[model samples]
Target: MTFTLATWNINSVRLREGLVAKLLGEEAPDVLCLQECKSPVEKIPLEQFAALGYRHIVARGQKGYNGVAILSKTPLEDVDGRDFAGLNHARHVAARLENGVVIHNCYVPAGGDIPDREANVKFGQKLDYLSEMRDHFRAQRPHKAILVGDLNIAPREDDVWNHKALLKIVSHTPVEVAALAETQEAGRWVDITRQDIPSGNLYSWWSYRSPDWDAADKGRRLDHIWATPDISGAAHSSRVLRAARGWEQPSDHAPVFATFDL
Candidate 1:
């Protein structure tokens, strides 16, 4: 089977459910994974999505806070969500397709403005969450799996507009970057985005604070898509729907896409 997948930080799925519908109408990926839904599972506006042929959904949500969901055009079985770091946040969810491929969607905590773990409790939690991810993947090696989400870390120099300038910032900081790397290594996951794009100032997220985000173009590749090496070769057409960021009242982060033939 061949299918296209997209991952996005919708920020607040309910607030921007229309944007989600618009994307589903236009881009029409087979599967869409969303983070920061900020609504209880029962409260997610699924009727609208269901009318558009996205009849299957698996989600973990928290009222007015972190949440994640996966909507698929085809039938899929829920693989449940994990509370990484025991944070009790709806930060992760997984599903399995009939073809046997597993999809893991995650929303890593955004470490606060202060990067120092000692100075910020959120920063410490971020590190601990990543450590648990690394340990989990190390113990249970993944195969024929694709992991996607707003990981909230930009690991590569080219992932941000100004690497040096943002190094001290939360997302591009070396400590967070290293932790993400370790997790990826533990899973033996191939970064499907970088593998296809290879190089360039690739970005999926722009700060909402920027008055003219498009003109300034100070963005970071905080979202990601990764697949296990065994089936990584089947993945292609990696891209970021940059124009989505320009939509009216849009999410700061745009959608990232990849296709796989398995």
Candidate 2:
């Protein structure tokens, strides 16, 4: 079976329901995973998405903070969610398709501005969250699974707009990159996006603070789609929908896509 999957950090699914609808209406990926939904699962505004033919959904949410969800045209079975770092935040959820393909949708904490964990609690939480992820995958050894989300760390030099400029920045800091790399290594996850489009500066998020986000093109590959190495070769055609960031009232981040012939 072949299906297309895309992941996006919608910021707030309720507030930006229109944009979500627009993407569903236009792009129509077979499965869509969203992070930062910021709404309770019961209040996710599913009717509109259902009307658009994406009737299957599995989500974990909170009142106004981190949330992750998966909406699929294909059937899905709700799997467990994990609260990494022992933070107990609504940041991760999993679902399985009829094809037995498990999808893990996550929203990694954005380590605060300061890189020093001693100076920032959130920064500490981010590192701890990644640490737990590494341990989880190490213990369980996932297979035929895909992990997608706003991981909040850009591990590759070409994944950011400026490597040196962002070296000390939270998302591109050396420590955070090393932590994320360790987690990926533990999981044996292949970055589908980078695997397909290997050479160049690629970004999935642009800061809202930059008024001329497009012209400046200052962005980071904060979001990702990763598959277990066993199935990584089956994945192809990965790309970021950069135009989505230019849409009316768009999220700071854009959607990323990958096609899999499983």
Candidate 3:
């Protein structure tokens, strides 16, 4: 069967509840993986989503930050939310579908304003978190996995609107990019979004600070969907719903999606 999966960093599921429903109605992806929910699991407005036919949900959430959820039309099993490098943040969650496909959703820490780890504790923690991810995936070696989320790092020059200008920026810094690359290599994950749309300037996030976001187009491709080598060929029809960024009080990041014939 062919299934469409999407990943988005909603910023706060509670705040943008309307946009969530709007996205479901418009895009209609079979599985929706969300990050940065910023709400407790109990406050996720489950009934509202259920009314729209998303009956299955697996989530990890805290009070006001760092949450992830996987909402699917298909039943999910073996849901897991584990700490990365003992960070104790609600940043990772995973579930297995009946079709034997595992979906791993993550919201990697956004290293603060400063790019230097020595000057920033958050930056150091971000690097450590990625290191732990690399170690864990290298040891476990997940197969037929679809990993998606706002990884918070733009690894390529094409991922940012102005590579030279954003080189020292938090999300596009060399350290952050190198750490993300290490984790990608350890898991042998193919960046599905980039794989299909390779030769262009692509971005899934535009800062709210921009007055004319669409015209200025100063955006970053912080959100991503990656598939393990075992099912890489099945990955197809990837897209970034840019219009979502223009929605009412929308999240800083947009949805990234891919279709897989698994």
lDDT of 2 by residue, 123-176 (tens): 999999999999999999899999999999999999999999999999999999
List candidate 2 stretches off by more than 4 Å.
Answer: none
Residue 176 of model 3: what lDDT?
87
Report the alpha-carbon TM-score of model 1 versus the true structure.
0.99
Candidate order by lDDT, highest to lowest?
Answer: 1, 2, 3
CA displacement after TM-score superposition, residue 209 of candidate 3 (Å):
0.7
Which has the greatest lDDT?
1
Q: Tell me the deviation in Å of residue 61 in model 2.
A: 0.5
Clashes of each: 0, 0, 0
Alpha carbon deviation, residue 247, candidate 3 (Å): 0.7
Error of 2 at 79 (Å): 1.5
Model 3 regions more than 4 Å off: none
Q: Write the per-residue lDDT of candidate 3 for residues 1-262, one digit (tens) a residue.
A: 7999999999999998888998898888999999999999999988888888899999999999999999998899856777997988999999999899999999999989998789999998889999999999999998989899989999999999999999989999888898999999999999999889987899999989999899999999999999999999998999999999998888989999999998
TM-score of each prediction:
0.99, 0.99, 0.98
